[model samples]
Target: MTRDAGRPVATPSQTVGPFFHFGLTANAALGTLAKDGVRGERIGLRIRVLDRDGPVPDAMVEIYHADAEGQYGQAHFDGFGRLPTDGDGTCVFETIRPGAVSTRADGAQAPHVNVCLFARGLLRHVYTRIYFSGDAALDEDPLIALVPPARRSTLLASQPSGEPAVWEFTIRLQGEGETVFFAL
Candidate 1:
């Protein structure tokens, strides 16, 4: 007896890690409301925690910002929301563009969203602010310059989608692209 030569063959290989395919979960709270139905935008943030070896599933992400009109308050603004990344380690936030805030110093900060990251095994949560890449105001922003040149890139949010109004970014926990931490 002989086996058929046309039979499919099987090969063994290493399994792909979750980090490579991050953001594959559904967050109910972040879903959009409609008269007929509910739709949700996938929360896909490239989050990297500093000094951590791999993805932190328990990390809680929160973002606060104002609407397109630059209005933030109880009547117009909804408070912050908490979200956790899927096994792939990505969190999504349904937020609007924040208004430009004036710094204590001479210049003003560009319209930007604020991000807060909290995870297990960390003594304290990390605080970092994300800024738009092409905002003209960034050139003279004092806070943006406070970060060292080497680490400045990390603070920038990615515009992968190519929609200037909407933004995206990945936080590198280790290696290159690590976000800059603020003293406060």
Candidate 2:
């Protein structure tokens, strides 16, 4: 039906964005979760974001976890961190290894860090969990049981053979070896 031609067409849809370095800084302190006097096994977490094309330098990563006592809401540790990826698609966090948090079922959960990712192509941020490699509690965690055996490795962060205190996790947005993101 040809009516009055005074209406404007709607704008085309677009991805989240490419706001890589608008307000982010390279400050190392922003990613530090462990403060002075906070006690635990000091460790370094290295996260990498990738896609089929290559590294996602503009991505931002956030993490939250409990303290060494398997507790949260402590006065010493805030247990939260946020950092932007660098040119190598990497962000490093200096945090202590968290203790195993207990579950509602009276069972212990694996020591893990909760992660959130935000990047240009995503309409909304994605959520995931980073479990430490060699944690015996992984066998009993209820959530880990839900994931398939072959894919469970995607949720684990591994310590390089020579780097005793450094753990690395890679998030692949597409193609092979993609990290397992959670629904919530």
Candidate 3:
């Protein structure tokens, strides 16, 4: 609220409570379209959404990864996927591994998926990347190298027990160990 002259004035504000999913979600999370019609080393991923207060249910996560050759816009793969969290604040994706991508300014980026997160209490969407944990090139990836060392681990996705090519990761939207968010 703001004071105008002698009386209190209304201030504009917005919150990501209940109504955001309607516009941004087009039943994208209802199925596994991201994995359809592609052939390569298939990988499964599970992401848990958390915040300072703990589990954040109904959050939406969108991801994009390059094809096997680190190229995009392929005839067989669209390179984009979207998923909404379950009541337990869990989201899953089944997509092929992305090859390394090169950037003129940053050199090369390790195999990873770009992600966007949307949920209640956020003013706007949060953007981040999910890098494969075992990548030897992770330390020098242009984007990963730019991030502070301590926080870089938050962006990595680790493989779970005995799950052949499956990976797991967690996203902390705020508070301690919050995941990094790019300005863009």
Candidate 4:
């Protein structure tokens, strides 16, 4: 049987635009459950999400990580979170240091947080990894090893001068320090 002709051959992907804040930002205001009851060493991260010209004033951030003991996923303690950036394109996440998880390859993965970025003009969210400079096992991370040495620093968060357990990292969408995004 022949089908009707009036239809889109493929649905176009929706791009983030001028009004994404109304929905995603509302969730960010209430997304910090880890700030209160989780275990392990707590950490506060500050990040600036940037595009080619400059900072993305209204970017959104999402993260997933394992618990202090490397266990993750549960209704009671889901390790997922979302945060919206301020006008300065800065976002913060308060959570505990993620524990290392064993890989099928050979060794355990280094302690790190997985991040997803959403901002205006992006047709799809971008993915990246964040590693703590304070981790003693940082050098052994398999993922980090995959990146070139020169660009690897972009993935590691460093502690600020006077803030204990606080780390800083900037996400550059393009140009010189563009962050390395994973395919899947």
Q: What's the TM-score of every candidate structure?
A: 0.66, 0.91, 0.84, 0.85
* lDDT string, candidate 2, 43-123, tens digits: 999999998999999998999999998898788997999999988899999999999998888998899999999999899
**Global lDDT for candidate 1?**
0.58
Best by lDDT: 2
Residue 34 accuracy (lDDT) in model 2: 95
lDDT of each: 0.58, 0.90, 0.82, 0.80
Task: Give the clash count for model 4.
Answer: 0
Q: Model 1: clashing residue pairs? A: 43-92, 46-171, 48-171, 48-173, 49-173
After superposition, the stretches of candidate 2 with alpha carbons farther than 4 Å from their true spots are: 1-10, 25-27
lDDT of 1 by residue, 64-143 (tens): 65444444444545535556665556665555445566655755677666677666544566677878777787777778
* Displacement of the residue 176 alpha carbon in candidate 2, Å: 0.8
Q: Per-residue lDDT of 89-155 in model 4, one digit per residue for the tens?
A: 8878777778897788878788888899888888888999988876877778888889999988888
Model 4 TM-score, 2 decimals: 0.85
Q: How much RMSD separates candidate 1 from the native structure?
A: 13.4
Candidate 3 lDDT, tens digit per residue, 36-109?
56777888888899988888877888888788788877878778878777777887787788888888785778
Error of 3 at 70 (Å): 0.3
Clashes per candidate, residues 3 or more apart or on different chains: 5, 0, 0, 0
> Judged by TM-score relative to the true structure, which candidate is superior, 1 or 4?
4
Ranking by TM-score: 2, 4, 3, 1
